[model samples]
Target: MFAKTTTSLFTLALAALSAQAIITPTSPDSNTVVKVGEKINALWTVDSTDNWNDVEIQLMTGDNLQMVPLATVATGIDGTKVASYSFDAPDVSPYSKIYFLQFTNGGATTNVTWTTRFTIAGADGSTTEPENSTVYSGQTVQWGTGTLLSSVTTDGSSNSTSSSNSTSDATSGGASASTASTSVSMSDSASSSDSSTSATSESSTSASASGSRTAAGASAASASASSSNSNSGAGQVTVGLGMVGVASLVGLIMAL
Candidate 1:
């Protein structure tokens, strides 16, 4: 009977140990910033004999004093006492919010949660302070929808006007540049035409001089030919007269 009673007490103690789950975070302290999807280690303790074969680790965040599960961590192991897990944070909005880890057994008993008030930085580890209201207070209040709408409209109109002015300035500058380029091209073309015209005039003047010289040379040759023809006629007439005179002298000799 004593053995049975001792065994019952030991079993009760073991059950109590299995019913409780404790988790403590060693990284990302209170009011500290940690990047989303950053790996962090956590320490947990659980009952070993209870065979609490599973435990789901989750990131908890929310407002109104009610924390909600934001992300779940796949630790991939049965809950073990004094074990460490590298938890990858979720990619959530950067806010100065209460971040915590919740370790719960697989329907074995009540769970344990540890809260760490932390800020979520950017992916590049760049930190930004939370809004003024969210900095010190836990409650989050936002501006009214109508006020936001009016501000957005005003900003949009101003941006549109600025963009239109910039575009107009750019277009005007481009047009001025195009006009300058066209003027330069026209000037070049005119210069080329003037050079062509001068060359043609010079060529024409050379042709005219050559033609005059040819005509003058032809006239001189014709004059020389006329003079030669007249000389030849006079010589022929003189020879005929000499032949007649010789024949008359021979007749006189014969008569004598």
Candidate 2:
């Protein structure tokens, strides 16, 4: 009986070591936080298997969002028994997401996943003014702020939470574009001011010169008319005097 009990204990210990399919990840650490627009390259190293003929590479992303399925990658067998895989970041993406690597060959399999959390965000792109990062009026913005732009694991098997899951509820904008336009207007303002002043000065100078010429012409015409009138009055007075003198002489001759 003692021999049988000893045998059972040895078998249990072997099972515990064989069931250890999960190992350390070569990629992002579990619970790691990443910014938006990051390329999540999930990699794994597995325990060698008896069947290398049917090795498979698989990745899964889990959150409250359903319909997103597992992905498959095809890498040929290698003598090293270690495999590497990569995926490029998309043009637009959720605020955050979860990713892990897996290896399978028939009954034999290996799993490597993060133990903590991971995150991606726009804040990684640049720092914002105190007034422009977000517009919620004092609401705290978590790393995984909402469901629309984030994801979480399911089945109650783990404690995973992303943003509220309302990707539409989130909105973002940048002052860079608006600031560029404003800069253009500011540069042109100096030219506009100079042009306005030059136009006003030119108009005033032209009006002053025209008034001076009109006043000078009126004075010349008035002087010429007065001189002609004075000459005619003098000639008329001389003619009248000659006539009176001649009549007086004729009367004296007749009396003699």
Candidate 3:
């Protein structure tokens, strides 16, 4: 009977030691707050002989510390079993004030590495409140202070609690595409305006050249008209002299 009890005690002590020889989370401390969709280095120290093939990563969030499965990562024994995993913080609406990490082997009875309690929040430290919450006079609202109005309206009310799950996984790829298209359109418009300006400049040059030629032609035409008028005046004087000589000869013949 004594031998049996001693054997049982030894077995229990061995199990305790085995359980104690597990992973140790060593990156973010208890007071650290993580942002949604932010990549964090999950550093840990592991036993060299332990199996790392089926290590499960989980996040315990919310006030109740609800378990949410994260991912399964691989750990290998390369001289020092110090493992570092990159983890992207999840988006949970109404930030998780009480959150921690749990890393364990995939087994019914296995040792675990429970990290310190941290916070999971939006990138801006923003949280969502229940839509049916009641606010009295001078009560702060959602991260902002609001002044109470003179009148308060209470039409319908209910006593219930609800939970919402949100994710920040969607990226801004569509916005980037829209910006690229806008840039291309602006470039095209600029090119079109440059072409129009060039055409206008060419038209202005052509008009200036045409105006200069018209001015030169007008000057030449005025000079030619003046010369022709002076020649007509000289011919009229020569004809008048010949008519006078003929009248004088007729008078002399009459006197004879």
Candidate 4:
């Protein structure tokens, strides 16, 4: 009787061990939103044991025995070493729907695990309406309101590119304005210099002509008066030229 009891106890223990799941899905939780034709990774943690040697990853809907397979993600994956699989989401007609992933062991006894429900959006950003059902099935899946994939990822990059282009254009415009301003200033300086030189030349010529006239008029009267007039005229010309030089120097300083 004791041997029979021991055998029954061992059988129960084996059944309990077989009932335990070997794969625990960690990604695509209830809040996940994926788009059709987009690549996604199925990640999970392995409860390493001799119960399973290989796994089959599948996209599924429904709950428990009513679970429906939507797509096969991978097959015959080494369960002990591989913890993640990458695959593109298949294009399903009426692509907007809520779904989950199922991991099934390929061992002698099937051990299954499932991820939480997630939304799959269509190319137009449409999604399945949120329902009150907590269990994920084909028609009755629960999701949050407005749980659609955002366009920010693609729009943000385009906005960044536009901003960079605008900045570059502004910089180029500023450089051109500076160049034009410098050219105008140089031209003004040149014109001022030309005017100063012309004024000095005119003043010297007028003074020389006045001196000659005064010397000639005084010579008819007295030699001493002629010499005094000539000296006075020369001093006036020197003072006028000095004033022009000072004015030009001031203008250069102001321009700088």
Candidate 5:
């Protein structure tokens, strides 16, 4: 009877150990921030004695007694070979400080492991602060609908494109203004140079005209002086000839 009781006690202990969780979740811890529609990996390490061949990953919320299943992350994961399960995070509303991942052995609810609480952000990069104090009427926490990450990324890219276009337009406008200013400056300089050249030409022409007038006046005075000298010589010659002829006529009458 003692041997039978001892064998029964050992068998019960072995059964209890088998029912305990052999999977240990390692990721999606307190510091993890999961985005909606983003790929997330639920990483874990399994005990060497694990006998489970398949597993199911679930997104859970609330305390242990009132735990709520938010979504099924993955099912039929090969527990024997895969230490992690990858899935797209559901489009669930931002939940702060109360979200965790639960891994269950295939067909056994008792054999399960849970990761530490993590945050889920919306597609608009919206998230609540950790340790939120909002009051809840029930023990179960529910996630509302949220936008997808793809939509947010596309919107951000569009805004960036618009900003680049605006900057390019501004730069082009500035360049045109600068070019206009330079053209105006060059035109003003050219006008000033033309005015200076015209003034110099006029001064040269006036000087040339004054010099010609002075030369003409000198030539006329020289011609007048030569004509006066010629007339004076002719008058002296005529007076001398008349005086000699009269002297000759007086001498001949004395001889007779």
Candidate 6:
């Protein structure tokens, strides 16, 4: 009886860890925001974890309605290993997007999303940044929906907004970021949430953009609306947009 009980407990613990199915790309996260029509190269670490399945990079842009599978590989190093993935620049346009890594092995599945950002341009485009929040279009950030730790970790505390606009950062699908307390500091299950958040922050800082502010907002809103359903945690956190910039632009625009 003792033996059986111990085995059961061990099995349960393993299952808990296994429940976290994922394909976490360690590079090119959403926290960073880039301009339109520029070369968008995303580097990610793919780890599908369950007995080897197809590892893939799924890029969702033009606000979720557009999904393109940039890369995939079947054979891997082991049940848990690291592999680098790079997605070539997408078609030029003025839009925002999000990204995620997926792992599928028969009946099992796992996914990890970065707090990232992206942008496409119509012309040479331009990035209009407000010098001060008090100015018109001077950085009036709008938050949206998507309930969860994203708010807490992203901003240290979760924030919510009433704006129904698709671009509201709180919404699920796109670049609109929801506000959180800015207190937590991406400290969840390290390998999963916490680590991903940190990686996203590094990427967001390097993002280079060139274009109009209004254009960015419109694109972000459209993506958020389209991504509303497909994404599990949609429109929950109310991250301020203009008043404050995104905390971390994850590797590849995990937000879009």
User: TM-scores of the models, in the given order?
Assistant: 0.38, 0.33, 0.38, 0.44, 0.45, 0.32
Clashes of each: 0, 26, 0, 0, 0, 79
Model 2 local distance difference test score: 0.48
**What would the TM-score be for candidate 1 when compared with the true structure?**
0.38
> Tens digit of lDDT per residue, candidate 2, span 102-197?
555432435323322244345555322222122245753222222233332221212112343332234222355567668878867867888888
Q: Which ten residues in a row have the lowest lDDT in candidate 6?
A: 147-156
Candidate 3 backbone collisions, by pair: none
Better of 1 and 5 by lDDT: 5
lDDT, candidate 4, equals 0.70
Give candidate 2 misplaced runs (Cα > 4 Å).
Answer: 1-190
Ranking by lDDT: 5, 4, 1, 3, 2, 6
lDDT of 5 at 227: 79
Model 2 lowest lDDT segment of ten: 152-161
Give one digit per residue, the lDDT tens place, for model 1 in 111-155.
655545566555787654434233226655321100010111122
lDDT of 3 by residue, 1-256 (tens): 9999999999999887765566667866655777776755567776665545456555543222234433332323231354766556655545644556667666323576667556666788774442222244665222211211122111111111111111121235556777889999999999999999999998999898888888888888888888878888888999999999999999999999
Error of 5 at 200 (Å): 99
lDDT of 1 at 243: 96
Candidate 1 local Cα displacement, residue 44, angstroms: 33
The Cα error of candidate 6 at residue 95, in Å, is 3.0
Clashes counted in candidate 2 amount to 26
Candidate 3 residue spans exceeding 4 A from truth:
1-16, 62-82, 107-109, 127-256
The superposed Cα distance between candidate 5 and the true structure at residue 11, in angstroms, equals 9.7
Q: Cα lDDT of all candidates, in order? A: 0.61, 0.48, 0.58, 0.70, 0.71, 0.41
Clashing pairs in 5: none
CA lDDT of 137 in candidate 4?
50
